[model samples]
Target: MEGKSWIFKNRPAIVASGVVGGPFEQKSPYSGEFDLVKDTLWMEEESFEKANRQLIESAIQVTLDKKTLSSNDIDALLMGDLINQITPTSMAARTLSAPYLGLFSACATSMEGLALSAALIDGGYCQKVLTGASSHNAAVEKQFRYPTEYGGQKPPTAQWTVTGAGVALIEKASPHNAPLALIEKATIGKVVDNGIKDPFNMGAAMAPAAADVIERHLNQTNQTIDDFDLIITGDLSRIGHPITEDLLKQKGIAFKSGQFLDCGKMFYPELPDVQAGASGPACSAMLVYSHFLNELQKGSVRKILSVATGALLSPLTFQQGESIPCIAHAVELSSPAVNSQSFRGEE
Candidate 1:
């Protein structure tokens, strides 16, 4: 059977899940699990280094429980984050028992991790793989813009960096496992730098990159806009979302507004007081791990193509008057069958 056929046949299941350290959980209006804020974990300080370590440990514990395997069972660990040279990920991986491979795609790091882990399992390079991403609001703010206490009012196109992390365990196919929807295809983004220089205007910087990847993904997969149940963009906020739709439509691909969603928008509707939308690796990661993952498990939605978008610009580059280079990574997820067995177990 062909690679795609094998993917569609032996669906991979996300047997376990975990999230560590975030400031969102402690903040106002987001304090309860039933409440959107409660559903997310958050950290208080600007310590991404600390948050990254917690995230990896939490994910490893969850994976161990779900797969009935230990850290030694994992053949490899793949991770990424929005920190410098992905320092948070690399440093966190040092403590893990599994071998590690660092990756980066800005906000798209988590989906990138998933895609790579799926490939490793499908290619028989590994049996069990762990993948995840983390980001802290304080660290990102200080690194990309001003400090959290800078007290600057942001423009409508600006986004709030989320202080959180999410991790998932991808394992080999087994008769006792539920079909954890496999990654049918991935559309790795090419760097799209159109010379948009404003650091505050990330929507303008990233819109084209999102459009480019979406187009390329559809073209490569031979799938139309209607092929998947949902087409989710990472952090395109209100500004970039419309532009992405326009660009895709210009390419003759039409996706319904209901079918199209943004993780930024989902993160906090009440925080509309927030400008461009929610951002940072954790913004999208939390939404996917908590909201979308649950929907998939309950069979509310079947197939989804999630694209995590990022603006590859730093405070230094922007200060140096360089344009923002943008990229996105796309991952596909599907619902497991009703008769499948759950992988939930004690750690």
Candidate 2:
């Protein structure tokens, strides 16, 4: 039953989350937010690929350790990464030897995993699910653009691919303990292409897609911008963030600036050389799990509409002059105390 969204009747609980960041992220103002910060992006691995595996696997371990449960206790592991064929995520899964599902929606993989994780539990497929995403800046640069060894000059519109990984454990909501937040609903996004061929200008390319999903979610749920405490957008960076607001305004759905924020812009906004800001699956995943979840725990926020956006483009596609198609997935997390009307009142 898809309304404006998929409302999980079981209300999957975010039992625990773990985040890890690279050296640049550790020095940023948001440094202290994550569970672990590596001094080197390489993490003592022979290659960036191996390092990415370490980052993601370590994050899952951190969350599992918090629950005193190993991979053996997990019903399934849903993971994704930016690499081609999602190699790092696959390697991490192999180490754990848990049932695995590989996913990719560019940078939107984090929320995609979370949304599916909720569905798995809500559908009685499992009692618990582990979901998350990872990305390595050096590795992505090699795949989509000039390698780090090239020292290529980047334009202001280019976003820095974040070197990080974030993981989360979600289970059925229970009375034994208050969850970090409840997964109430998710709005799947459609592919939106506006003939944008420049990979550097992803922010502009992705804004329309984010606006579309947000609008559909609000209209479908019979709710307004007034409902969520925060409307979080994934990886729209500085340039795309305002475009999203403008597009929404054109749709006659205006959102307050204070209430709307983007994970890409928030992650490393003021940092020099970060270009447009951070973009990667880990950008929104880390900011949401490591930072915003803490705020939810402290009673600073009761609910959030997290929309993770992704620009669907490959090196070959760009070379072939195809426009970048984009997508956005929104996940609504509400505190049990102020569950409010953000959820479906009748089912």
Candidate 3:
């Protein structure tokens, strides 16, 4: 990996994906994008944590079912969540029982998992890998701050963590099975700390990191923003979206974020309670696995970059008065029919 970026020659194919969303997600514009939607946030589980595990597990099961494959067919499973020690994800992964690798990147875990999965397949280490991310609003709120029952007043900048799970099975290109999207390249980001200690204002803390990775990805690929049909950032919410746009312009990469989609903003624009927009690991996972991949299949989009951002802060760290360190990972996704020449266009 040259300076946290790798260009894949083996271009693995995302064969199938599954998404599960909570009741609030059902209210979102793209609710129909999910394969399974729960009528309630609890998902009929006793505790919110158990329900979170159910979300991730449901996604894995559905994805496997769609492909008519089982854990035996999957070489490995990589997944992550925002909960402490990724407890929910670990609990869910046990059911898969494949050679599992659990990841922790706060929210950027989805792209982190995707980048690694592509590398594994491209490097000839595995034929197929299933990877994804999950996050629950209640679980996150209770762990990171106050419980939802506490009824704490969140600031306008605070974002609602998405309650959902999304998983995808990626494998080498085959003659019979057409892939949803092709993994072109990836740029891994470094930790960025802007000294913003407020955990509620995650957007401000993560905006710089998102811009940094976008710049690095474009530079490494020798391309510009316009080269891709869309540049998406995960869970930036309302506050961080414009700030990231402004940061990119300041770096001399002139563009408008309106041309791109922020998962947080698009998830539930009609829900007034989502002050900024949706967030957490599940936000980007759900959007990509459903909306963008569906569009790519329909030929509505040719090429897109999925950049999932994360705030690397723990409840203890925040309470101890440490600044929020953040990261972002970008993965290039494109329709198999799209000409790769566009990726070679610029300096």
Task: Tell me model 3's lDDT, rounded to 2 decimals.
Answer: 0.89
Ranking by lDDT: 3, 2, 1
Which RMSD does model 2 reach against the true structure?
2.6
* Candidate 3 Cα misplacement greater than 4 A, ranges: 1-4, 339-347
Residue-wise lDDT of candidate 1 within 1-347, one digit each (tens)?
21131132244556666654454534423223211222333333245466555555665565567557776877888888876787777766766757999988888788788878887876767877888777777677767777778787877778887766677777655555554454556767778988899877787788889898888877776778787889899888888888888888898988976998988766766766567677878767766766677777778887788898988888788889899999988877876644243233111
Look at candidate 2 and tell me the lDDT of residue 252.
Answer: 94
| Per-candidate TM-score against the hidden true structure | 0.86, 0.96, 0.96
RMSD of each: 4.7, 2.6, 3.2
- Candidate 3 differs from the real structure by a C-alpha RMSD in angstroms, to one decimal, of 3.2
In model 3, where is the ten-residue run with the lowest total lDDT?
338-347
Each model's total of backbone clashes: 11, 0, 0
Stronger candidate by TM-score (1 vs 2): 2
Deviation in angstroms for 179 in model 2? 0.5
Q: Which parts of model 1 have CA positions greater than 4 angstroms off?
A: 1-11, 25-48, 338-347
Taking the tens digit of each residue's C-alpha lDDT, what string does model 3 give over 76-130? 8899998888989898878888898999998899999999999999888998899
| lDDT of candidates 1 onward, in order | 0.71, 0.88, 0.89
